[model samples]
Target: MTVQDKLKQVAESLGVPFVFEDWTLANVEIDRTPLPAVVYVLPASGELDFKNGNIRDNQNGMLAFLDKVELNGNGQDNDSVVDRMKSLAMRFIVKLNETGYFELLGGVMKYQVAYNKLNAVTSGIVFDVTLKEVTGICERNL
Candidate 1:
């Protein structure tokens, strides 16, 4: 399976709705979702590490977008959204670690909490992931 396929599979295992490269507010309407409840695996910039003549590794930057929401009927709760975001992030990390196809490369993973300006109830967590594709057999024969 390709990297994208592995990502989608991971999201499926987590029971989180998965979207491909196209994930915009308009696209959210397709799901009739008032909140950002879907996980978007977007392909970002990447670099190809040249190995032997025919072998190379692809290191890619993928963005995982999750919901960061916490709103009791009363009002905005303190650190509730942040707590939820961390939980989701941890879950994602665990899932990625479990997958043999995608390897988490060493890099500073950036995270940001964003509020939906259009709708206050809709908040989101953006996670930047550095993944290395290492699922293949390398054969050398003279």
Candidate 2:
């Protein structure tokens, strides 16, 4: 499939919204959500990926939030906590791979996983991707 098609597939798989003109060009808008959410894009011919997304630390409100994952610690459930988070991350990455964009010519030229948030206001919702992932399969360039 063409590059655009590939990208579209990725968006659809992840339940993310996207618009494409001429059935080739694509426009994807990711909402800055809470709970470790993310929207990453990897261009072709690039070594890194761009994570123009958001990751709201749900556990930030409380301390020892991840203590649960620490099996050694009494009453600590770090395992479950970390597991759930890892699961979410896994799902996100899996969906992106299924997207047609990764299958584009040279496919996923670059990629990265970043962190950021959305400035939601009465006027409208604007997502500000603060942290951009410069490593991973999504790199600078081919």
Whole-model lDDT per candidate: 0.55, 0.29
State candidate 1's TM-score. Answer: 0.65
Query: What lDDT tens digits, residue by residue, belong to model 2 across residues 1-142?
Result: 3333443455456554333322112111222222222223333222223354422111101000010122243322433444454454455446644442232122232222111112221011112122222222322332
Which residue pairs collide in model 1, if any?
none
Off by more than 4 A, model 2: 1-33, 39-75, 103-142
How much is 54 displaced in model 2, in angstroms?
30
Judged by lDDT, which candidate is best? Answer: 1
Q: Which ten residues in a row have the lowest lDDT in candidate 1?
A: 29-38
Q: How many steric clashes does model 2 contain?
A: 38
Error of 2 at 63 (Å): 24
